[model samples]
Target: MFSPEGPTLRELAVQALSSVEHGYDLLAPKFDHTPFRTPDTVLESVAKALGPLGPFEDGLDLCCGTGAGTDVLAGLCHRSVTGVDFSAGMLDVARRRATGPVERVPAGPGTPGVAWVRGDARALPFTAAFDLVVSFGAFGHFLPRELPGLFTQVHSVLRPGGRFAFPVLAPPRPASPAFWMLLGFDAVMRVRNAVWRPPFVMYYRAFRLGQVLEELTRAGFTVDLRALPEFGRRDGGSPRARLVVARRPDGATPPPAA
Candidate 1:
């Protein structure tokens, strides 16, 4: 589901052969054209859902590739917005396309500012710097074992009462072709990692909802799930998508070392 201007098959091959950082660097220019970039619809829906929750002061867009979610942060946060990603190329693109004048109406405004930083999610550069943090479509890059550390880092950067929120879509059913497609992708990734160096860890099936919630709780967040009703329920009445809001309790101490 790529646009006409997206990366070619050759480019994809080259990227897949490289390390995750290098691969994302190579793909940065064409990332927005690909389906890998979070869609405006989903971002808008999330913004709408979080609209009532905010009036947040400072915001951070974690793993903010090419700054898609940064816009959402700008809309939700009052003071300022910052986007952080590991890929320098992605940060470059984000700065180049940065929004200068802030729009005011619903979310209140005073010259919306944007900043891009190159950093690792597991070791954030800030401590209690943001009132809210939101990530989009970046969890697949992290392995299951890395979740606790990653969540802890996010927790460390958030002020008390601050939230670490993101959207979680339900996995496709085993009977569905989409499920098989993802399964095949994960299978290929496993084999690739076994034989490759500097492995690129991206598996759609690795991040389970139950495990994620428990980890958030372990990280000292008060967790809650809000169904995104824009995308309707499934056949069994399960929500098609959900927004997970993990808030660090007000006045909670620093995240314990893992």
Candidate 2:
């Protein structure tokens, strides 16, 4: 669902037919008004979960779209916060939106410092510099094959014992309408890519938890999943939402080939 200011059906069609980067560049201006942006509630919940893990000196928001996850980092981090995104248009929006201090409960002090950078997540520019890193609602942009390199980059940026966190929602049931909707969307994307020039890469069901853990481990991260009880559990007893904390070891290995 999109707001009145969100992209039109025709605009969305144009974006879907373009490359992933180009589509995000086109959508970035009105992205926050669309359902694709990570919601404030999810951001807040993640902040609450990560708060105790911090008072961290520095934090980074990976693939920070409009800096939603950056806002969360600002709260938990003590000295500085950085939001990095590949799309310049998206970075512009994030810079504007994350300019002021973030709002928080109990009327306490605002977040740590904030900055925005335009860069690819697969090739982060920082070293063992950040105490924490978080991303939200941006995984769909990356194809399954890219996950290892992406994870490795994030791990490379984080300081020893630092976390690379993100929330993963359980996939909709096969019999559910949401599942059918995603299936149809993916089918349309397949058709469009067959005849189109640049391919947009976003798939609802491709990023499986098992595959993710394997990649994270291969990327030199010790992975753990903490169930987000607020979202409850599925019929098979799996969590509806999970906070994945992937930690790069103190002596992390050099990143493998892309």
Candidate 3:
């Protein structure tokens, strides 16, 4: 669902047909008005979950589309907060918004200065520089096969004992309408990629939690899952939302490539 200021149907169709980078570039200006942008409620919940683990020095927001996650880092990190993404258009919007008067986490005297960098998440352009790294609503753009390399990159950029945090929602039950909606969305995306060139890689069902935890462990992170109380619990008593906090072990380096 999109607001009146969001991308039109024709604009969305054009974006869906383009490469992921180009599609996001096309969508950047109106992204906040679209449901694709991470919600404030989710951001607030993540900020609350991360509050105890932090008082961190430097932070990075991986795949930081329009810098929503950067706002979260600004509150938690003390020294600096950087937002990195592959899309120049998204960075432009983020930069502009950062200078604007938009409502965001209150930046106190110790609040870190924010910066935006254009870089691919799979090959982030930093090394052991950040105490914390976060991502929001960007995983679907990455294929399942790419998870190991991606996690490795996140690991490489974080200082030993630093964390990579992000929130994940529990998958909907098979009988639910939301389940069918996501399944159909992924199916359509697969079909579109099969028939199109410069494939737009966005699939809702590809990032399984078990596979992610394994890859994070293989990448040298001790993973912790914290339930977000704001979203409550599912019918089966599992958390509706959980924050995946993967910490690179103290004084440890990334694992050697396979």
lDDT for each candidate structure: 0.90, 0.83, 0.91
**Model 3, range 1-258, lDDT digits (tens) per residue?**
889999999999999999999999999999999999999999999999999997799899999999999889888988788899999999999989885233323246675778788899988888899999999999999998899899999999999889999999999999999999999999999999999999999999999999999999998999999999999998889999999999999999898654
Tens-digit lDDT track of model 1 for 1-258: 778999999999999989999999999999999999998989999999998998798899999989999989888887778899999999888887776533222333454567788899999998788999999999999998999999999999999999999999999999999999999999999999999988988899999999999999988999999999999999999999999999999999756856
| Poorest stretch of ten by lDDT in candidate 3 | 99-108
Cα lDDT of model 2 by residue, 120-175, tens digit: 89888888889899999878778899898888888778888889999999999989
Q: lDDT rank, highest first? A: 3, 1, 2
Preferred candidate (lDDT higher): 1 or 3: 3
Q: In terms of TM-score, which candidate is stronger, 2 or 3?
A: 3
Q: Backbone clashes in each candidate structure, one number apiece?
A: 0, 0, 0
Runs with alpha carbons beyond 4 Å of true place in candidate 1:
101-109
TM-scores of the models, in the order given: 0.96, 0.92, 0.96
Colliding pairs, model 1: none
